[model samples]
Target: MSEQKFTVGSSITESYRFLADHMPHFFRLIYGPLILWVMVMVGEQILLIEHDIHINSVYFLNVITAAFAIVWYRQFLLGSDYASYRLLIKKGFSNSPLSFKRVSRALLRILVVSLVLLVPTLLLSFSMMVYFHGQGVPLSEAFIQELAFKSTLIIMLVFSPILIRLSLYAAGFALGRTSLRMQDIWKRTRGYTVTLWWVTLRAFLPLSIYSYILTLFLDVMSEKLSINYIVSTIIIETLAGFLTFMILAIVVAANAEAFRILIGVRDGDVPHRDGLKKNTAMPPQTNRRQTSKDIPQKTR
Candidate 1:
């Protein structure tokens, strides 16, 4: 297969098309995990409401759900459809173990890249603090605190590009790669930083707003109906979970599409070794069994 290039707009379009076509399969693949997540969330909300105790265990459950979601993305990229619930569970643990090992590895790579880019800002901030303290200025003063806060914002803005560039590690990891290298991702994204950022915004912003509005509307309706707070909360959380999963699927799909394009995989092209069909040109058919009389002859 030849490597294909993509623009930001094209990639966004492709991601939407992929989602539209495979939404049913994608939902089937994720329904179990989504239900589990909703249960966890509802439990947490109930705990907070009834006992006034925040259950930190939900975070662990969230991580598990995230791992499963990553596996789904991996399967999507590999051109797989929804498997049975049992098979999906088995694959999550066996085929793509979304253990701390893989998650931490990817996080560490991103953290290292982020810290390297942030070193200069860190040093400058430290130097400023030291100089201010030497001049009898308290670091806790409002002026110095405001300066630090603004400086932190500036640093975030400056390094945002590097952060965005490395965002594909999730997709890379999902592709069943043994290890992810920051340099490799950087190289792959050489000329597409702006495009990737734009695509991310295009994909994320609307969905986020829609989710928020939907939740708010549901809350208002529940209030008007005089429903129990816990019941309303559970309903809202369930719908919110579905929306969150959908957003996640779309984002992962977009990133996977971009990754595929970067690696020269065309849309609908599966690798031969995967025992999947390839998009190949068909050979012209010839009537090899035709007799000589079947052929048209020219007059002498």
Candidate 2:
């Protein structure tokens, strides 16, 4: 078994190089669907502004992100050799290689992992929201809601590293590399929890710093220019959208890279030699501790 240590710096660097090498095609792959998604987002923002509410509605945007992420993950894992419009998400939904069932299964697994970690925080946040809204102060309603939303985001950011431990399932499901069961994920990723956390921190640290600085700069610009408040705010809200998309794309690739490395080891409770297949028979088992057959063997 290749019990090699996870290299955080190398993972980030390799993912960056990979994206740099393939960015044009990558953008084409995501452009159409992403544009429509942005349109809807802008429409929602306009509606919110009309209602005198300032907070951005992000739940739908998150779903759109996840949809594109599946495409990116599968592309990286399956390689471009597979002849499918897997890149064209709009076409891919029905006409591409991924079956409706396969996508649904992946979505279900993602939801399960997300809800497990999110439920407790959500419950507490919900209680706080209910308590505040019941106070019935009209002006305070939007303020309280936005406060709760930001608080939830902060809590999520704090727990982000912990979320990375279960990332194998995220990248894995995109290619059906592992079973959907949480126990399977836990056993598959055991002993490497701390390593995954480090990867998350390194991957996101730059984005966090960049975000803070960009907000400061933009706020200064908004004040100095004396632009329309809604326009400036919308521009600010979506200013880092592309950078964020790129960073998250790199993170998804990094997760896939980590999965390819760690999934090979014949670790605790990972009974099979090759990875778990989506609908086919399991690969023949092995007792040699490790064999390089499931994923494309790479030269290090």
Candidate 3:
């Protein structure tokens, strides 16, 4: 690997372009899993409201939807048109069942990495709880809660780079590069530590802000705006549903695009049944494909 470069702007652009091109297929094949995800989210909220119970069902369901999203992303980028259109006829809309095994393994790895990113937050929260208890403060003490929240946010920001690099496992697995070693990951991703960090922060910081605003908006709607809770719930959950699907879709596309630009795919990546392959191997410096105005979306 030579000196590497990462682009936040073009990758995001390509990601949305990719999503737009596949929007029809997205609605068809993805609606099932997406509905399941939203149902779980709404159910979790209902349980909390009625019984004061909480379940992390949404997170687990995320793995399922993400698995399919990764499959579609890799399929669009690496699959052949014959294999794609042929199956698009037979199977409603998906052309990537061949990658089921790889998607499963990839998602498992991704799940682990995602969980790892929460380690600092979890440990800090736990430690704070213990410290607060020792200080005769309740677990729900407002001061401790605020302190822990701020500290966890700072820690996540600090660890954002690590999250970006580890996210390669998602791309690699989608491309059937499952047995990636850390040195390979580290080497292939050379000179991109800061760039990846910035990309991750830039791509997702708006989401964080939007969520915070939405939370406040809901509060205001119920309190000052005199909105009914059910109406507010419908509005919020509808927006949340769109956010869930959009974010999951973009994440896989961005991961696939970033991997192609930064690390690249070899000649025989994940060959399609029609004998097609992603032939371009981007140099680590990223002068070739990343800066190109147009990336061919279909194999001729």
C-alpha RMSD of each candidate structure in angstroms: 10.7, 9.9, 7.8
In model 3, state the lDDT of residue 111. 73
lDDT of 3 by residue, 4-48 (tens): 355888667666766675566666556666666656666777898
lDDT of each: 0.65, 0.62, 0.62
- Stretches of model 1 off by over 4 angstroms after superposition: 1-3, 56-65, 81-156, 265-300
TM-score of each: 0.67, 0.65, 0.64
Candidate 2: the clashing residue pairs are none
> How accurate locally is residue 252 in candidate 3, as Cα lDDT from 0 to 100?
64
Candidate 2 positional error at 227, Å: 3.9
**Candidate 1 lDDT for residue 291:** 20
Quote the lDDT for 206 in model 2: 84
Off by over 4 Å in 3: 1-5, 49-58, 79-140, 206-235, 268-300
Q: Write the per-residue lDDT of candidate 1 for residues 1-300, one digit (tens) a residue.
A: 135667777777767766675666667767777777767777777899888989775666667556655755555565553224454445542366457775576578667876875686777678888887889987777877676776677776777667775557666555555455767778767888778878888887789899999999998999999998778877997888788777777776677677776743434333221221111232223222222122121122
